[model samples]
Target: GYSYSNTVPGPIGSILGPAKDPKANATLPFACSLCGSCTDVCPVKIDLHHQLLTWRKEIRVKGFLPVSKRISMKMMSWLMQAPRMYRFVGKMARSIVPYLPRFMLYNRMNDWGKQRELPIIPKQSFREWMKQNHDDK
Candidate 1:
């Protein structure tokens, strides 16, 4: 089910597909996985992933994306682009996740955790573990 979106050209070509309605195309960008596999399999070699990314940017600019998705994307972008913030958030998540109640983390706000248990943060980061282990060498 997860890979279906990427394997087929429906979501990728929603904007340019045979559909005559704009409403049908507007939501198409969200369904694509943007995995580029479609482009590879296409007879004409269209850049499916690139177009999907462009459509996503256009959708964001048009303010069509849901607020929750937009906010989460913003947070993720910031977390990845800023190493300090990433480290801080990693430490905070690790320290707080264990202490927090299941209801708080597994609630409606967290769709990712709805289906399964959340990941357990390790006691030490890779950097810390390497530092300790390599100190003797």
Candidate 2:
């Protein structure tokens, strides 16, 4: 066997675990969950859940994934959970973007403002949207 440089497989399990096994691929499901969260969280808004499900259908039902990509699915599940943490990260990011050289920022994130406008920070979020709406009654 050729020497594979991937780190996903441990020294115990060789370079690649079997692709279809659930235990080996945490991201396969987490990607869908992230999709759901994104659908709810998108400010300008997009239906990420449907797209994720479609991706799943295309990948699993259609058997389109290559051997290398299947095992790397564990990355998504470990990423997002707390609202405060997410907001903190957003604030940190927003604080940083203005300082970056404009060309560097533009080059790093293509279409950085092609559609999205600079966010107008609201007094509260959509959760607060309902509360404020009800309070006006």
Please name the candidate that would achieve the greatest lDDT relative to the true structure.
1
lDDT of 2 at 80: 51
Pairs in clash, predicted candidate 1: none
- The segments of candidate 2 whose C-alpha lies over 4 angstroms from its true place after superposition are 1-52, 60-79, 108-137
* lDDT of model 1, residue 78: 81
Question: What lDDT would candidate 2 get against the real structure?
Answer: 0.47
**Per-prediction TM-score, please?**
0.63, 0.32
Tens digits of per-residue lDDT for model 1 on 53-107? 7777877776777788889888899889999888788888878889988889898
Candidate 2: Cα lDDT at 50: 62
**How large is the C-alpha RMSD of every model relative to the true structure?**
4.6, 13.7
Error of 1 at 68 (Å): 1.4
Q: Which stretches of candidate 1 lie over 4 Å from their true place?
A: 1-46, 130-137
Q: What are the lDDT figures for the candidates, one per model?
A: 0.70, 0.47
